[model samples]
Target: MDYIDSICNASASILDMTPAVRKPEEGKVVLDYILDNCAKWPNKIFLTQPMGGDEVLNVTFSEFLSESKKMAAYIESLNLPAPSQIAIMSKNCVWWLMADLAIMMSGHCAVPIYPTLTAETVKYTLEHSESKLLFVGKLDTHPWNEMKKGIPAGMSCVSFPICPSDVSYDKWADLIGDNEEIKEIKKRTPEEMATIIYTSGSTGVPKGVMLSFKNLTDTTFGLINTTHATENDRYLSYLPISHGMERWVGECLPFITGLHVFYAESLTTFVQDLNRCQPTLFLSVPRLWTKFQLGVFKKMPPEKLQKLLKIPFISYLVKKKLLKALGLNHVRYAGSGSAPLPPDLLAWYRSLGLELLEGYGMTENFNYSHMSKPGGGRVGYVGEPSEGVEQRIAADGEIQVKSPGMMMGYFKNEEATKETMTEDGWLRTGDKGELDDAGRLKITGRTKEIFKTSKGKYVAPAPIENQYISNIRIELACVGGRGHQAANAILMLSEDAKKEAAESGGKDAIEKELEELIKTVNSGLDDHEKLQFVAVVNDVWEPENGFLTPTNKIKRARIEEEYNPLMEEWYNSKKKVIWHKW
Candidate 1:
């Protein structure tokens, strides 16, 4: 009658890794095994990404270990106390994880910070957590500069690869100063803190969730069992490494499964990088995947593409091949998380021969909760409580969980931590959802984001936003109906579609097209749930503005505040982009 039993014994024909049932008792606790094994498989093309033309930065297993050790030695020389916080900020790349491993190896806790965080949020987090050290990749500047202004005096700092900056950096060769027989200090307990991951900052000021080595290790095993990830698989670490989803899959699981990981340079070029890498398993948040899907549609004008695909023969053959060729071909295992993935998007991705799986987890859970089971076609449900994970639906329908991956507690916030979990110890996931007939988890919506209109209709902004975006334009949409007369959407235009519209028509025409697009998107929703108004964002939301979180989800609260006053005019008027002159 329990959740796991219900899932394992459910009515579905899913792939079972039964004969090779993974036993945690048999898994290694140390991170050394993964690093060492990759060295042994040195010639197997561990990690790679292409540059402008024929130029690629490739790392062999042996090179990875050497660089990590050098960075680790540099980490030791900092002489910070054990459990000192080492924060990482940047886009996903090989060095990002390298610094993360170095922090762990040197006995410091890694705190992942978003590159897109606003100056104010960065100030609050750095000072609140009292993190002494930070490693920023060369990609982002504002967060680093803003964070620099906020830190207290004498806080030690480091940067990836050694850029010339005020903060000290690892010189690689000069880092040998720690030697004269450097002793490797190992924390024997799995409960020893490994990282303090702050919340995605979607709703409010981020809460620092302190996770231990056992939490990371156990979650890695749980993910391995659920996804059947192996040493031979390749992963593209294009997602922001700051988010929990990225930390678990892009960082922890690689240690557990020994998968090779390559980083894409920037968000603008992620798809191109994805094609160059041909990753075996790619993990990303829903926003990016939906953008990729939109890009595919834009390449062939949607009406033309949609009609051609409607023909059974072409749909069966040509359309499938086109999607696969666009770097999506080898993504055997694709996982979506950070924010809930729209079920409609999942079904559409599948239509292109892509296996889209939804994963549920938060920083508080060390990013392990429920993952759709392999071979199980549970479209809307986050499959089952992953191996070694326990899930329960609380009285109010919030999904609560107990797992080895649970954090030690919120950093220096005992009262807040206590409030998050039950007295008996289950971490409460703030989002609300229900358990289906098959015992699978279906996330209905966020409890807080739901708004009730004067007419007595309760509308959850997420589901409404998903309906607008799952198969439509707008990179990300946030709904705000509470306290307002009606609901509206703040949208970021699709990059590819924007470009196509520009080439075919002028900017004014492109803007006009978006208005029509909004009409079509709105037609699918109800009078109450449908957006009462829409705003087309000319510029995309970036991390610098704090309008977007690191995982690329919109910072809804910030957007609402910025646009709060305009609602009157927009709601009173009719078309999209109320601020921009039509």
Candidate 2:
């Protein structure tokens, strides 16, 4: 069977499955949503914190409300300003949400810092945001020790109930202990600042995007309309809640949808946690999706699985078994965003009965822009502009958006803000995209990432890289040939691929396989866009290594800078593919 064509035909007839449009309640903030839900379903499990060994800690809606109120009362007792700026640097946990709610209910703006950031960047965010108080939650002891040194001497610090060892600070428990529940929560206007989220700093210094209560509420409603999530829906919170996309969907969406949110205990236990929660809504970035694909290939070789899947009866069983093994059988809605998801990956999942949708958004807009419609699965396009979102392709090909969910602007960066917006008030998305006949948005590449070759032809690397990354063996691919004859690629092998190479015919066989892969990819590209040489690097691209942003996007400029010096040497060697020596 021609699965691709079959799937496309099936998808063409799939109608939009979203629920009827229900306008968001007027003049209500996220806190109000939580409070209302608590009143409506006091005993509903609001959050589940997974503990290793099959143990879990669940918090009911009423308990969450009460604890948050007590924490808010304690925050008010500190006598801080009405709109104090507080920072939370932690991984996803129950305490993180508690601190976030407390900060908001206390009429303070929350500044979320990615726990994976370097100490220098962490300090920069703390100092740049001018945060008055810092809530230290789940973090690595060594990094926290290093980061704490940079905190201002007089800044108040509070530690979550469970924190890194040897960290001496005010405990969150002390703040809530024996404290009277705050009878009245501070009322915040829809336009008031709710949080200042720092970007992942892939290219340069992270900018603080100031999102208002209106932005959050608008995005929450927009997502609800798109995904049709319900109170009974379960969501696994594994992605860093610090990310605006995750914050809006994984964290804030629950407040309005009344979804039961589960926290992944750690990376090692993610698969187990996923099985335990059986989340109906699963949101992940491209990298994790790629990793999940790799995990599947590891269990069953691609050739064998493909052959087996050709049998109609076997295909159903195969997909069911595979999805169950991956703990994704119950995922009613699965989405990939933050970075581009390869079309092949999307189709592959669709073939297995999981419709993985592509979404597009940025922190500036609180992540409400475009998403693939429930059943309108246009393969490469991130479906039509979301309800109430206006989008256009500029003459330069940049995608621009006008939405109610747009951030107020980058905090304290008026000049930068002015540069990001057009005279007509549309926010510059920096992404180059095209709209299909059906009005689905297909992102071509980043405007800044397009590079010119010596022949004066411009090359967009993302599409080219996507083809190479579809191969499970390749973990990352960076295509560059600025001022050169043709583009070259830097390939990072997946751990399983590396192990296979070592166990099989070693580097020689790996190079041969990669050359064939490159040839296959090049056949689909234009003459100016074809790669001349491919360089394989043994290093892993990770957030800690500064090669990837917290959201798992590659730092292209940084990668180019690190490898540009070796380009000429690799080219002069006359090898079709060269392995870079450290």
Query: Residue 23 in model 1: shift from native, Å?
Result: 2.3
Residue 73 local lDDT, model 2: 89
**Backbone clashes counted, model 2:** 0
lDDT of each: 0.68, 0.83
lDDT of 1 by residue, 140-169 (tens): 554666655654556555555523255555
Q: At residue 115, what lDDT does model 2 achieve? A: 77
Off by over 4 Å in 1: 1-19, 30-32, 35-45, 49-54, 141-148, 151-153, 162-173, 176-181, 185-187, 306-320, 455-457, 496-530, 537-539, 574-582
TM-score of every prediction relative to native: 0.86, 0.95
Cand. 1 TM to true fold: 0.86
* Predicted structure with the largest lDDT when compared to the true one: 2
lDDT (tens digit, per residue) of candidate 2 on 279-395? 778877777888998888878888898898899999999999998998988877787766666778888887788887777778888877877766776877777778899999999
